[model samples]
Structure formats: C-alpha cells, structure tokens
Target: MEQYAQDTPKWKAELFDWLKSFLIIGSATAVIYLFIMAPYVVQGRSMETTLHDGERVIVNKAIYYLDDPQPGDIVIIHPDASGENWIKRVVAVAGDTVEAKNDQLYVNGQPLQEDYLNENRLKSEAAGVVLTADFGPVTVEEGSVFVMGDNRNNSMDSRVIGPVQLDHVVGRAEFVYWPFNAIRMPK
Candidate 1:
C-alpha cells in the first residue's frame, strides 16, 4: 500500500513538470509568431492566379522594416488608418508612371508584361471605367507605391484607391501553407 502511494506522487510530479514545460514553450512560440511572422487568409479573389481566396499565407513582417517594398512583391496593404487590411501586388514604386489604355497597361511608358492575367478578363472595359480606361502619365509620389491585383479588371487597387504609402504596408507575403496540395511560394 505504501509503494502504491509513492508511485502516485511520482506520476503527479511528472505530469506537473510536463504542463509547466508546455506552458513555457507555448508562450514563447506565440510571442515569436506575433512579432516576427503572421498568418493571413485570402479574403477575396483580388490576388487570383497568384493567391486565391481562402488560401493561407505567411507574411514576413520584419522585412519591410529593413528594406523598402520593391515592385513585383505582393504586400498586405492597410487601405486606411482604421480600415481592414487588403492585399495587392506592388506594380510601381515612387517616380514611376502607371497607366492603362486600350485595355493595356504601361509603367514608365513601357508596356508591362502581365503574363499572369487572362486577356479575356482584361478586355471587359465599359466606357468611363477608370480600371482599364486611358489615364495617367501620372508619376507616383515619393514614399508611396502603386499596387494592383493579378486579376486586373476585377480588383480594386491603386487604380481605384490611389497609391499605397510605404508606411501603410504591413508585410510581404511569401508562402501559401494551406489546402495542402496548393501550398507553394507565390510567383
């Protein structure tokens, strides 16, 4: 009976040690994730062909703090100070001109090769719609970057929201981790 009693205390001590270790490890992981990287879910089809709706992606939050977001990198944008975060691809940096004419896109007066888009969708240009309308030769201001979605005609991006200030960018999204088979680095 005494031997049985000693065994119970030994088992309890082992369980207590495990719980403490678990709590410490869990807390550390949460802190690291919160400060360094974050997971985001695609809320819309704005980034289609590159990132789809309902996909899970990891954002490298510490990157922009060390370097500016270059054109071609997909970034999470904070539309307004208090608005919900949105995603878009950086199309042009400061001093660059972005324009659309005849359902074609140009950056710095050179045609942008948008191989990611389906031409049929970009052809939907109703009159007076600025999305694919002829405009600009407008130079982007300092400290801001122009952004657009991969699904050109369907996304509400810089063409609609104006330039995204570098300060308003959250992070660069580099990997998709969800849906198992769909997991891969976005081009």
Candidate 2:
C-alpha cells in the first residue's frame, strides 16, 4: 500500500525532527553549563547568614572574564590544588591593604563598611566576643584578592590561605536558587 508507506515515512520524519531538536537543546545547555553559568552548592557555615550550608547558587562563570573581582562581590574560588572550592566575599583587591583590628575591618587605611556582617557583628557584640581577630596590614598582591567569610569567626578564608590568585577564582555567585523560601541574591 503506497499510502501506508507514505504515512510511515511521515511518522519517521516527525520522530527525526523531534530527536534533532532535543539534541540541539542538550548541546546548548551543556555549553552554557561549561562556560557561562553553573550551579554550586554552598557547603559550609563559612558564608553563614548570607549563604547557608546546602543552599544552591547559580554562579556566573563568564562574569569574571568580563570584569575583575572587586570588593564586596561574592565569588567562588578554587583556592588550591586539591580541587576544593570556596565561596567568599572579596574584601580587598590587588594592591589594597587589608587589616582587622578591634573587630573592625580596614582597607587601604580606611574602615570598610560591611553591612552584610551586621547581624553577625551584633550577635558577637551582644555575646562580648570578637567577630574577627586582629591580623593583616597585608597588601593583596597583583592579580590576587583578599577574601573573607560573612561568619568571620568560623570561616577558613584568605586569612588562612593567603591572598587567592585571580586565576583560582571560579566565578561570581549571582544568586541562590534552591530551598524556595530562602531564595535571594547575596550582596
């Protein structure tokens, strides 16, 4: 039956079209994930208040390619050769001097306003504890940044690992997308 043969080919053609569309979409998604954007899971309390453990964030991997990491930008970093990643706030960029004294952060000889740490600072003050201990007068070297956690007292950051090389920075964290009720763009 000539008619039956034509119908069979039409159905096969439709299936082929569907398969091709799916292939194209899959490729686009893979490209974006590899070079443009990717999801990262926050793993510790280091970024607490701003980002909590187990929270999911969408990192804009392509951003740093267009702009250098700057103070106050939340970024994802590959600190060392062990393949571990960290998320932290950039406190000082190349050539900037950073220091913490009397629980206040100073950069370039001026006190830095850290509104993001308001809650934690208040809590520490209430508890008669120092949030960030005195350290640094350390200048960030060329092509590196000084990073710190929002939960200053409990974080392992650039203070512990030294200035993070710009090449080690993975991306800027654009926003948190998981646990619907907790969704927000970290400042």
Candidate 3:
C-alpha cells in the first residue's frame, strides 16, 4: 500500500503533462482550422478538370478578409446555410457586365479568355447550344460577383443562381493536397 502511494504522484505528474500537451496542441489546431485555413473536399464534377470529386484541398479562409475575390480566382461559395459549399471560378466582379453567348464569354463587351478550357472541344460541343446561356450587359450588383465552373456545360453557377454576394464566399483554394499524385497548385 505504501509503495502504491509513493508512485501515485509520479503517475499523476506524467498524466498531467500529457493532458497539458494535448490541450495546447488541440487549441492550436482548432485556431488554425477555424481562422486560418480549412480542409474541404470536392464533392462533384461541377468543378471538374480543375477540382475532382473526392479531391482534398486547404482553403485559405482568411484570404477574402485581406483581398477581395477577383476574376479567375477559384473559390468556395456557400449557397445557403445548410453548410454545403460549391467551388467555382470567379468570372466577374461587382459592377462588371457579363454574358455568355454562342460559346463565347464576354465581360463589358470584351472577350473573356478561359485558357483552362479546350477551345476546340468547347466550340464543337457547345456549338449553337449556348451552354452557359446569355445575359448581362447587365452589371453585377454591388457587393456581388459572378462565378462558374471550368466544366462550363456541367456547372450550375452564377448563370443559374445569379450573382453571389461576396459574403457568401467562404475562401479561395490554390492547391490540391490529396491523393499524392494529383497534388499540386491548382491553376
């Protein structure tokens, strides 16, 4: 009985040390995940050829607080309060006029280039179909911008839901971090 008591303090000390280390490490992880960045999984082909389903990436949640979303930025947008988010590319910012007609993208009457797309394939597939449909010459409302997926024909984005408020955007993703071989900076 005396031997057990003598060892109690040593055991308690070791347990306390472990718990303290755990708490500190946990707190740091929580802070980084909640405020700095978050891991997000791509859910669908909406962002295909850019972000694949099941692909994992770290979203820099602090980015928008520092820099406004810009055209060509790949961002995660929350369409509602359900916690579901969509990843898409910013096509136009507040006050910009945007349109998709006969397979061409136009912003403020100037052609918007999408180097990520295979021009020939898109032209052939979207021939006379107007994949994204047409609109605008209408200016994006203040505090909102237009977004879309690289897989133009398959994505439902600003063209369907209308320009999204900047506040609805969660963050911008710059790279893929999953599946090893597919890991790299996203275009």
Candidate 4:
C-alpha cells in the first residue's frame, strides 16, 4: 500500500508540472496575440495581387510604437469608428502631396515605382482601362497617411475615405502565412 501511495503522488506531481507548463505557454500566446502581434484575415479584393482575399497575415501591432509608418509599408487601418479594419499600402505620409494622373501615382512631385502593381497595370492597359483614376494633388495632413491598394482600380482607399489618421492605423502587415502554397512576405 505504501508503494501505491508513492506512485500516486509521483503521477500527480508529473501532471501538475504539465499543467503549469501549459498555462505558461497559453499565457504567452495570449500576450503576443493581444499586444505584440495579431493574425488578420484579408477580407476583400481591395489588396489583391499583393494580398488576396482570405489570406492570413501577421500584423506587427507593436511596430508602430517604435517607428512611424512609412510610404510603401502595408498596414491595417480602422478607417472609421465602426471598428472595421482594412489593409492597404501606404503611398504618402504626412506633408506629402499625392496625385494620380494618366494612371500613374505621384507623391511629392515624383512618380512612385510601384512594381507590385505590374500585373494589375498590365491587365488594365490590355483591357484599355485606366488602373488608377485621376485624383488630388492634395497634401497629406499631419499625423495622417494616404493609402491605396495594390489593385488600384478596385480598391476603396484613402481616395474614397480621405487620409487615415495615424491613430487609426492598427499595424503593419509583416507576411502572409496561410494557404501553404501562398506563403510569402508581402512587398
């Protein structure tokens, strides 16, 4: 009976150790998901070619705390108070002038090299359609960013919503991690 008692205590101790480990791991994961990083599922064709609908991406929520978002950074933004998040590429930052003429995007008087839109641009031209419509020479206000989608013709971006306030930005998209075959770092 003494041997049985000792064996029971040993089994219980081992189980307790495993439970502690699991709790620690679960807590760490929760912390990362809540404050450091988060998984976001792309919802529409707005960011297509660069990010397709239903692609899973990891957003670095803590990154903006260290540095301001820059042009060309793909970011998740809450455009309105409705709590809906949209992913887009930052085309212009505070004080930069943005314009789209003849289907070309110009920021601060210089044409942006949007190599990511090569496929979409070619498709548009082949179809005799303008990829990006003509818009403002308006300067981005302070603490705001001008965003657009890689699928310029189909995206509802800053062009439709105006510049997004810095505070509305949720995070920068680091990479696509889903659909196994489509895994890659978004440009």
Better of 1 and 4 by lDDT: 4
Candidate 1 lDDT over 1-187, as tens digits, reads 8886677877787898999999999998897686678998988988887888999999988898899898789998898978688989998999999988876789998988767665335444433344455667667899999998987657888888899899899899989999899989987
Stretches of model 1 off by over 4 angstroms after superposition = 1-27, 118-131
Candidate 2 lDDT by residue in tens digits, 1-187? 8887677877797898999999999999999998999999999999989999999999999998998999999999999999898999999999999999999999999999999999999989999999999998999999999999999989999889999999999999999999899888998
* TM-score versus the correct structure, for each prediction: 0.79, 0.91, 0.88, 0.88
Q: Of the candidates numbered 1 and 2, which has the greater TM-score value?
A: 2
Q: Residue 183 in model 2: shift from native, Å?
A: 1.8
Q: Rank the candidate models, highest lDDT first.
A: 2, 4, 3, 1
Instruction: Give me the runs in candidate 4 sitting further than 4 Å from their true place.
Output: 1-22
| Residue 185, candidate 2: C-alpha displacement in angstroms | 1.3
State the lDDT of candidate 3 residue by residue for 47-154, as single tens digits: 777789999999999989898999999999997778789999999999899987766789998988787776434664757555455665667999998998887778
Which lDDT value does model 1 have at 165? Answer: 91
Give me candidate 4's TM-score against the actual structure: 0.88
In model 3, state the lDDT of residue 140.
90
lDDT values for all models: 0.83, 0.94, 0.85, 0.94
Instruction: Flag clash pairs in model 4.
Output: none
